[model samples]
Target: MKEKIKKACAIWNPIAGNVRRNEKNIDLAIDFFKQKGYEIVKKATVGPLTATQIARDAAYNGAEYIIAIGGDGTINEVLNGMHDTNAILGIVPMGTANLLARQINIPTNTVKALKSLDNVDIQEVSLGKANDRYFILMTGIGFDGYIISKITSNLKTKYGKLAFAYHATIESFLYSYPVFSMKINGRELTSAFAIVALSKEYGGLFSLTPKANLQSEQFQVCIFHKRGPFTFWKYFISALFRMHDKLPDVTLEYADTIEVYSEEKVWSQIDGELFTQLPVKISIVPKGLKLLVPRTAKHSFPTYKESR
Candidate 1:
């Protein structure tokens, strides 16, 4: 007896970073899947949120798997479309920063990423929700959110990840660091910046929230208590050293719900994309997404009730 072929839709964004190179890699990935007996359906996104629409259509059309073939932003868009459906999520890291891919132990190398698909395993992961939008990795308020708002497509296309660093440096001196209040799990808290993180990794291999687990039903909220240039640099240095959690002004807590409000309107970012303004409620949706991960990846399995 032979196994049945699974249907997969590859979602690619032509305007994503490293377009020419990524397109070649995407072709290779598509060919590989086809050779393995997968019924490949190729879909190229035309504009913002187009990947979401394509993925939604693919899911409705009964695609067994929906593969996002760009960076984290592209993956985020595809996730929004597929979250309400039963199609499994697949990723090919071809973007500037494949944060979620790295978090799940997916290789950055295109060939390696495709090869690992031979032993793919499916696992359910929790997602963070802010009103109607769902985020798989992290959400930011204040500083990081403002940075996302400042990033332009041209800057991102030219400098890639360095665009963030460049903008952050300029924003530190020019942009006002606003204070925001959070009602985290019923307790009131104030911070200059806050990150509600579901994944342990941030900005590639760096771990901003070391204890964060995607399989867990809760989020690790890191609050930066101080404001100003010196404090920002201090926190940046600590995060670079992977010791941000040890700083006195930085507080980490586990919560399933958080409500954020600002006296003055402030920006918010979900998975590196500018989402909405403050005065939003965020909560966890446990086992909300099914991801296709490497079979050998330990964290791909559910870790219910496990600390950290």
Candidate 2:
């Protein structure tokens, strides 16, 4: 009897991030998986939400593995397209802020990232749900979200990380920092900025929620109790040094569910995409997705054993 050939769907975003070199390796990636005895379906995104549709199509067609070859936002779309399929998720991290990839120890270099897949294993990881959508990274409410809402594709691709900083700096001075409320653990707390994190990496720079873990089915809610440009800058410096949690107005708590609201219109960024209009509900979905993680990322997953 002949064995069945497994199917793998490799999805890539041609225009995501600074992918001049990474885009060239699309063929290499497909061949890499092909050599692994898998039939590969290579697709590129034409615009927004295309990846999701492709992923859903692949899942329904019985693909065993769905590899995301773009950034976090692309990965998030692929994830959303996925339903209750037994397919495992993989990443090739090619974006300006590959925070999700960085947190999971996935290499930024496309060649190295593909090579690293040789020593990988599968793990069912927890995912965060913001309203009806799912996120592998944190949900940024207020400051960061405001920046995301204003960022353009050309600006992001050209300026890269500086694009966000540009908006963040300019808006910090002009915009009024409004205080919002989030209900966690049956308690209502007020804050200017809030981070509901599953992974420690925020904005692909610093660990905004150092205690947050992707493997855990809980969120490390980091809230800034004060509102203002001064407080924002202060918290920025403190978080940079990984000491913001020690500050007076900054507080970090763990929760499974969170409801954020405000009389003022608020913006949010989920895995780097702009999510505007507040009153968003966030909660943890335990063991929601099966992820193909490298052995090098064992530190991020404490309970991860070298089963392979």
Q: Which candidate has the top score in TM-score?
A: 2
Model 2's alpha-carbon lDDT is 0.86
Per residue, candidate 2 scores C-alpha lDDT tens digits across 172-191 of: 88778878999999999998
Q: How well is each residue in 44-162 modelled by candidate 1, as lDDT tens digits?
A: 99888999999999999999899998888899999999998999998988888888878877888889988877776678899999988999999989987888888887788778889
For model 2, the stretches where C-alpha displacement exceeds 4 angstroms are: 1-4, 305-308
Off by over 4 Å in 1: 299-308
Error in Å for residue 90 of model 2: 0.6
